[model samples]
Target: MNLKSNYLLFLVFLMSLGCATNPFTGKQTMAIVSNDQLFPASFKQYDEFLKENKVVEGTEDAARITRVGQRIAKAAERYLNANGYEGYLKGYQWEYHLIEDKTKNAWCMPGGKIVFYTGILPVAQTDAGIAAIMGHEVAHALANHGQQRMSAAYIQQGIAIAGNVAITDDESRDLFNQYYGVGSTVGAMLPFSRSHEAEADRIGIILMAIAGYDPAVAPELWKRMESSNTPEFLSTHPSNSSRIAQLSALVANARAEAKKFGVTGFTE
Candidate 1:
């Protein structure tokens, strides 16, 4: 490689540097997008979505949703604060809403904006189940997983642009970009998403435990989720059976985590 190529490679490496850990998985990950840059974008999009959707208010489900969300948020704040991540959510504006849509999902954005669909309520089944999902989704936000994925995408885009400049043939550049997109989207992005799902499950278990929920119920909820047979990728969530198995395996440890948080008389 020539000096220019070497320098460019070094620049790319430097851009990949700044690190953050997954709060649940305890794994160091590349965090190219700063929280400062990510939160505003998430907040704006969340607000726009709320404006466009029918947000239900003053129902039993809505009340339960808010209560569960607040409990998990408190648990998250306590865990992060105790671990010296106090200011991580400093500018976060947390809000929760229940949407009347029948979609079988819930999501919490980076700045703590939450949306719950009506369809998910049946499978959620109980307060602990709702806490399970909230804990998992909020864990993703706190871990900055979305920001990490965005940063990785930007890096891949930069590489593709550079490759296109170097390759004179349009077909060759097209091929390069196509291969890059597939490799980055599937190889990197999908697996990264899967990692986030697993980490969130672990974190969610602990948060539920701390919030006085029987963490054991989390596995059963996942079992319900698995029975839903929702298409994984299009739906933007994990498979029910996979999550169920993972949660079941983590039960013993989840109970231990609950003990640390002084959770007693756990639901049987």
Candidate 2:
């Protein structure tokens, strides 16, 4: 067989061997790096980050962060169990911390380690708003986005290596490197990230609703984010306007889903 055929077979094998099911979507997704490996490294990095940053503690805001995060986590477990994916969160060690940072951002690592920056509180505005943010961040972890991203990076690197090995001409290889880097990022990676964000948004609203927080608050939160000058194209997240519209459309369905979980009333 030719070298090109070997590379193609290797790529196919890699993809086939590194697949896991997304509990929420029930779809097969990339999982080149297993959670057993990813979670320990993620937990260590989270601990290191906390040691390097100021973590708010013993305050009302700090307590609220933990409270909302726990509720979202419970909602996730309920959803997963109800959908026949019991014990899906067996290895998850959930922890939430509010960091004393000016950046209006929050993130959840692979194994349920979460950090919320202080600057985002003004944007969150209320408990429901906080839940809106919390649910979205938590959904990312629940959906295995971090694992997929790492797997995708491995695939991207593998493709680059194959391209380099195939190109004998030095100048052609150099040109391929430059164009491939930009093209792959803009054409593939960005879109992959945006899809994750959107999936998180959809899952988040359902979680917030099940947790007894108004899913309607999600669109409002995005509206505020839009007013704060969030950009659109070539970004990792969806444009705020599109997010708002999507959330608005999903609010009724979220509420209905929550109703199935015995959560009929939502607090704003």
Highest lDDT against the true fold, candidate: 2
Superposition error at 187 for model 2 (Å):
0.7
Per-residue error for 225 in candidate 1, Å, reads 2.1
**Highest TM-score scorer:** 2
Error of 1 at 96 (Å): 0.8
Tens-place lDDT per residue, model 1, 1-98, is 97557757865785768788766556777778777888888899998998999999989999999999898888888777777777767878889999
Score candidate 1 by TM-score against the native. Answer: 0.87
* Residue 60 accuracy (lDDT) in model 2: 97
Clashes of each: 2, 0
lDDT of 2 by residue, 1-268 (tens): 9987799789878877768899888899999999999999999999999999999999999999999999999999999999999999989999999999999999999999999999999999998999999999999999999999999998999999889978999999999999999999989999999999999999999999999999999999988873435465578888877889999999999999999999998999
Q: Report, for every candidate in turn, its global Cα lDDT versus the true structure.
A: 0.80, 0.93
Off by over 4 Å in 1: 1-14, 169-174, 226-238
